[model samples]
Target: MNRREFVRWSGLGMMSLLLSGCGILGTSAGAAGEEVQKNSVSGGNKMKIVVINSSPHARDESTSIYLSDRFSAGAVSAGHQVFTFDGANEETHPCRGCDICHMNGPCVFSDAIENKLMPELLSADMIVLVTPLYYYGMSAQLKTVIDRFYSRTGMLHGKKSMLIATAYDSADWTMTALSEHYATLVRYMDWVDVGQVLGIGCGSRSLVEKSSFGEQAYNIGANL
Candidate 1:
């Protein structure tokens, strides 16, 4: 199936099942299952993770997209109940800064995040954002979503979050812009930091494929 079709269907499925399971199967069943398997517990303290991939490139083989996919696979292997969203798709509309979310309780765009993402967040124990560097910062697409997340206010409070970025520059300071950006959110929501992966020297997909750090990044995802 096409990427658009896949995300559209996945969003719909997530919404339907997330709501249904609340009454019939009980909330946190999926998250609980992961906890039992990963933590050696039966019913307590499960962690739900929602990973958002913020690369605007369309191809499945883009550096950031592949990294995000690998991370998702690793998260599943680590026994975490994970949900993934491709921020590259246009289905996720840019936040217009209209402040409609203040009264609407979600982004006024209402396509990907409002209907699908909020439920995942409500059900998740943690969040992971994976993106590529765009002008020394997160891709413009991701910045938009991050801004929209402001509407969530205290909803994500106390939850764990991590940032993963792949860039062409090897300098540590290359990620400073995103670090500053996420720092504000961390301060705003009072979230705990699980980890952050800054993969440098990776502007092209070939570079990402050739880089040794890609494997390390994948391991980070698998272990987290």
Candidate 2:
């Protein structure tokens, strides 16, 4: 079926937010001192976006954080509200796949999601995951959060989402695995896929700062 038909059959409430391209939703103002815009699809358009920076590296070195900052700034510039959580600073433990969360609710670990992340997520119109590559795959830090997401019991369904990833090399390969992981959730949650920002060919912090890719990231934010 076509996209619209698929959305209609999904049984999700009237596609609340854009639900793609970073998966931010709702009608909220951007960051302070920013302008809001009318939605092209609907007359009313304000986005409440929550950003999760899942990079294991420091926020300064996190390409995911850096790129997301650009997008967040862009959202603000366009009059959208953005909230962010850095997994690096969060104290979540790894998922044991014990299926306890599946039986219960939320994860058993102590981390930002249980405290800060969930509160923001429940109120957010959209959700964005910013992560780095580890061995050509998602960082373990981000994966831990994803595992915890199952505890939501389909709460994330129909929510908007975006994934931003940075890798030193062969990053494209990681996208398949990442997409597969998200696809499973999207199928059950009725979430939509927006766009992704992939930054490849940069490893060191210095390289990222001086690289044009950084400027591209900034532009991405400026336009978001």
Best by lDDT: 1
lDDT at 9 for candidate 2? 40
Off by over 4 Å in 1: 1-46
Candidate maximizing TM-score: 1
- What digit string (tens of lDDT, one per residue) describes model 2 on residues 70-100? 7787667656688988777677766676666
Q: Model 1 over residues 103-219: C-alpha lDDT tens digits?
A: 236666768777877778867887788889888878877776666665564465656677778898888688888877765555445565555667788888888878765665555
TM-score of 2: 0.72
| Poorest lDDT segment (10 consecutive residues) of candidate 2 | 34-43
- Give Cα-based local distance difference scores for all models: 0.64, 0.62
Worst 10 residues of 1 by lDDT: 20-29
